[model samples]
Each structure stands twice: as C-alpha cells, then as structure tokens.
Target: MAAIASSGVKPITGMLRRGLILDLSIALGLGFTFGSAFWYGYHMPRTNARDNFYKKLEEQRAAKAGN
Candidate 1:
C-alpha cells in the first residue's frame, strides 16, 4: 500500500524535525543562563562594608572573652 506508507512517512518526518528544533532551543537557553552567571560572578565589584562587619564581630568575641 504505497498511499498508506506515504501518509505514515509524513507524520514521522514532521515529528522528528520538530523534536530537533525544540532540543536546539532548550540548549541555547541553558547556555545563555550559564554564560550570564559566569560573567557577573567574574566581574563582581569589591566592597569593604562586609569586611568591616566581620571585623566587628571578631572584636565583640574578643571583648566577651576578656569579660
């Protein structure tokens, strides 16, 4: 049955093409997310405010021990 075979072939080919497109799109999205995270972390700014806070905590601990 040539007609039946042709009909089956069409749906199979369409599904395979759609699957490939979906896979490629998902891969691109993941790549973008990872790339942005890496870029921001690598270029993060330096701040001394956090360092000062930790230093204050250490000072408090030392004072408590002396008491």
Candidate 2:
C-alpha cells in the first residue's frame, strides 16, 4: 500500500513541475513580443519625428546665416 501511494505522488509532482515551467516560458515570450512591438510602433516613430524636426530647424538656421 505505501509503495503504491509513493509511486502516485511522484508522477503528480513531475506533472506539476512541468506545468509550472510551461507557464513561465509562455509569460516570458509574451513579455518580449509586447516590448518589441512597443519599441517599434511607438518609441521609434516619436524619436524619428523629433530628430527630423531638429534637422529642419538647423537647416533653416544655416539658410538664415547664409543670407
């Protein structure tokens, strides 16, 4: 009787550990995907727009100085 009970417990423990690891891996993958999407969709566009604005302003200043 004791031997049978211990055998049952081992399988349950192993299944539980596998389930936990699967859940963690899925969470990590989702976090990386969302972070990349945010960096490309939101942050990069804003940074590019600001840089362009500065470049145009500098060009205008140079034109004014030339005159």
Candidate 3:
C-alpha cells in the first residue's frame, strides 16, 4: 500500500512540474513575439517619421541661412 501511494504521487508531481514549465514558456514566447511585432510595426514607423520631420526642418533652416 505504501509503495503504490508513493508511486502515484511521483507521477502527479512530475506532471504538475511539466505543466508549470509549459505554461511559463508559452507566456514568455507570446510576450516576446507580440512585443517585437509592436516595436517594428508601430513604434518604428512613428519614430522614423519624427526623425524625418526633424531632418527636413534642419534642411529648411540651412537653406534659409544660405539665402
């Protein structure tokens, strides 16, 4: 009886540990993927646009100074 109960508990604990690891890996993977997508798709374009605007403004200033 003691051997049977111990055997049963071992498998249950092993399954629980595997399940926890799986859940954590999945959550981290999704977070990294979505975070990368958002950075490249949305944030980068806005940042590039702002940078371009500043460059154009600087060019305009240079042109005015030249005149």
Q: Each prediction's TM-score against the native?
A: 0.47, 0.77, 0.79
**Which residue pairs collide in model 3, if any?**
none
Model 1 agreement with the true structure over 1-67: per-residue lDDT tens digits: 7788767445555787899999999999999988878766653432355677888999999999995
In model 3, which runs have C-alpha deviations exceeding 4 angstroms?
1-11
Q: In candidate 2, residue 52 scores what lDDT?
A: 100
Residue 27 displacement (Å), model 3: 0.7
State which candidate, 1 or 3, has the greater TM-score: 3
**What's the C-alpha lDDT at position 17 in model 1?**
85
User: What's every prediction's RMSD, in angstroms?
Assistant: 6.3, 2.8, 2.9
Q: Taking the tens digit of each residue's C-alpha lDDT, what string does model 2 give over 24-67?
A: 99999999999999999999999999999999999999999995
In terms of lDDT, model 1 sits at 0.78
Model 2, residue pairs in steric clash: none
lDDT of each: 0.78, 0.91, 0.92
* TM-score, predicted candidate 1 vs. hidden true structure: 0.47
Q: What is the lDDT of residue 8 in candidate 3?
A: 45
